[model samples]
Target: MASAPVIISAHLSIPDAELVERFVRASGAGGQNVNKVSTAVELRFDVAGSPSLPEPLRSRLLARRDRRMTGEGVLVIDAQRFRTQDRNRDDARERLAAFIQESLSVPKPRVATKPSYGAKLRRLDEKKGRAQIKRGRTTRNWE
Candidate 1:
């Protein structure tokens, strides 16, 4: 079990085995560098099979509507903004760590409640004011 390349947080970390990085030629303007060098990095993480993630967290991550996420529960991050392989690799790893750390946190469930009497009254008053404004517009002065 090799140490992970990126550390998500103090307590949680994804193993290096679960992460796969592939370098490819970056698209766009970069003189001869773009044509010859493979600076872009494609970092892939298997969210479903990673033992580091809890079951609930895995499910939540997979459930997210991210186009980068594959149907097979793999999250693919493309880092090509940088001109160097090291920078791109670092960027990819940082993004993956941020994403996983974000996924680890559970959102508080919303508590349902009826509108207050004052709020209802305020809403009705606003509606009445708008109705008055429309009535005034209809009886406008055509000079």
Candidate 2:
């Protein structure tokens, strides 16, 4: 059996066996060629089933709201921008690499912050000024 292709990223590498690639005909303005040739590449990655991904990174990827991710934790990337099968294949691989790279970095946790006293005072003063302007615009009737 042939060894799986290895995809390298900044932090980790994934085997090509973890990825599933399917070729389909792209629907667009290409006259007859589009109908005859399967140029579009559909790359599928099993985020939940992949042994290559760490648990934390897998969870982070699954937490994403991208439409490309299926309910079953499979990430589907369609590469149809290029007409040629080879180019589309390369494009799909590139996109998969990018997604894996994105998962490598841990996001910084947000620190809880409170408004400073001076900031609160400034906000109140602005509101008071706005209220005064509105009050001054009121029409007064002199009998």
Candidate 3:
């Protein structure tokens, strides 16, 4: 039987069909097993083509500066840290879920702020104190 859809958030759940998993040989430090078993998982999700993702959320995901995201809007995750296939699969799924969750919320607009008068005064005082210390180090006598 197929597993249930992966839940990312209360509102967002990714269907298993949208997630494509491929098993490949992992490189690095697993001795002979690395060459023998294809433990690494490559998870690919077509963010742009996915029907489940809303338009705004899709745009937000595409706006991210992650290298894993392709120009075509496909997000590729390679899981090779773990030696076991199951662990790597879970890791990839978790990462995909995390990425989706991040794009779910709209970021708050930043309010422009300036230093208060007291803060400015405190900064000026510190600068003056530093200047005074430097002035004291200068030799008074001309050699």
Global lDDT scores for all candidate models = 0.90, 0.88, 0.94
Q: After superposition, how far is residue 75 of candidate 2 from its true place, in Å?
A: 0.3
Error of 2 at 95 (Å): 0.8
Question: Where is model 2 poorest over a 10-residue stretch in terms of lDDT?
Answer: 1-10
lDDT score, residue 63, model 3? Answer: 94
TM-score of each model, paired residue for residue: 0.91, 0.90, 0.87
The list of candidate 2 runs beyond 4 A from truth reads 1-11
How much does candidate 2 score in TM-score? 0.90
Please state the error at residue 80 of candidate 2 in Å.
Answer: 0.3
lDDT of 2 by residue, 21-99 (tens): 8999998989999999999999898998999888999999999888999999999999999879989988888888888
lDDT of 1 by residue, 51-101 (tens): 888899989999889999999999999999999998998899999988888
Higher-lDDT candidate of 1 and 3? 3
Model 3 clash number: 0
